[model samples]
Target: MNIEEYRLYCLSKKGVTESIPFSKLPNVLVFKVKGKMFTATDINTFDSFSIKCEPETIEELRLQYDALEEPPYFSKKHWSRVVVDGSISDKILYEWLDISYRLVVAKLTKKERLELEHL
Candidate 1:
C-alpha cells in the first residue's frame, strides 16, 4: 500500500493519533495511542517505516518475510521497520499494525482503557 493508505490504516485503530515527533524528517508521521507510539511512516517518501512488535514474533517475521529489526532510532528487541518496497503483502502489514496497537493498548491505564471504550 501507499503512504496515504498506510496512514489511514494506522489511524483507523481506536485512540490512535498521528504526529510528526521526529524533527529531522518533517514528513514522517508517528502514530501513537494515549501518548505512546506504536507505528510511523514517511509521508513524502514511503521508503520504510517502523512498528512495535512482540519480541518473540520479531525474529519470526524477519526470517519469514523481508522484515528486519529497527535501526538505531528504536529498540531492536521489540521494533521492526519493514521496508515499503511493495513486496510485503498488505495482510501482513495490517497484522503488524494490529499487534502494535494491541501492545500499546494493553499497557494503557484503567482509566485510559475506559476512555477508549467510550470512544
Candidate 2:
C-alpha cells in the first residue's frame, strides 16, 4: 500500500493519533494510542515502517517474512521493520498493524485503556 493508505489505516484505529515527534526526522510520522507509540514510518519514503511485535514471536516472523527486518531505532526483540516493497500482501500488513496496536493497548494503564475504549 502507499503512504496515504497506510496513514488512513492507522488513523482508523480507535484512539490513534499521528505526530511527527522527531525534529531530526521530521518526515517520520508516528502513530500512537493514548500517547504511547505503536508504529511509525517515514512519510517521504514509505518504503518501510516499524511496528511493535511480541518478543516471543519476533524472530519467527523475521524468519518467515523476508520483508520483515530489525528496526533501525527500536528494540530488536520487541519491534520489526516491515519493508513496504510489495513482497508482502496488504492483508497481512494490516493484521500486523492491528497486532501492534493491540500490543500497545494491552500495556496501557487500566484507566487509559478504559478511556481508549470510550473513544
Candidate 3:
C-alpha cells in the first residue's frame, strides 16, 4: 500500500495519533494510542513500517514472509519491520496492522482505555 493509504488506515482507528517523534530522524513518523506506540516508519521513503507483534508468532511470521523482519531499532521478539514491497497485499497488511493496534490497546490500563473511549 501507498504511504497515504497506510497513514489514513492508522488514523482511522479510535484515539490514534501520528507524529514525528524521533530526534535524530526527523522524518520518521510514529502512530500511537493512549500514548503507547503501535507502529512507526520513515515518513519520506515509506520503505518499511514496524508494528508490535506477539512474541510467540513473530518467529512464524518472519519465516512465512521474507518481507517481514525484525526491526533494527526495536525488540526483535516483539516487533516486526514489514517491508513495503508488492509481495504482501494491502489487505493482508491492513489485517496485521489491525491486530497490532488491538494488541497495544489491550495492554493499556483500564483508566487509559476509558480515556481512549472518550477520545
Best by lDDT: 2
Candidate 3 per-residue lDDT, tens place, 20-113, comes to: 9889989999999978999999988999999999999999989999999989999998899999988999998999899889999999999988
Q: How do the residues 1-119 of candidate 1 rate in per-residue lDDT, one tens digit apiece?
A: 88888888988888888899877878878999989999887777888888888888788878887655555578899888888877888898888889889998888999999999989
Q: Rank the candidates by lDDT, best first.
A: 2, 3, 1
TM-score of each: 0.91, 0.98, 0.96
TM-score of 3: 0.96
Model 2, 13-119: lDDT tens per residue? Answer: 99999999999999999999999999999998899999999999999989999999999899998999999999999999999999999999999999999998888
Query: Which stretches in model 2 have alpha-carbon errors above 4 Å?
Result: none
Which candidate model has the greater TM-score, 2 or 3? 2
Prediction 1 TM-score vs. true = 0.91
| Alpha carbon deviation, residue 4, candidate 3 (Å) | 0.2
In model 1, where do residues sit more than 4 Å from their true spots?
none
RMSD to truth, every model: 1.3, 0.6, 0.9
Indicate whether candidate 2 or candidate 3 has the larger lDDT: 2
Superposed Cα deviation of residue 63, candidate 1 (Å) = 1.2
- Per-candidate total of colliding backbone pairs: 0, 0, 0
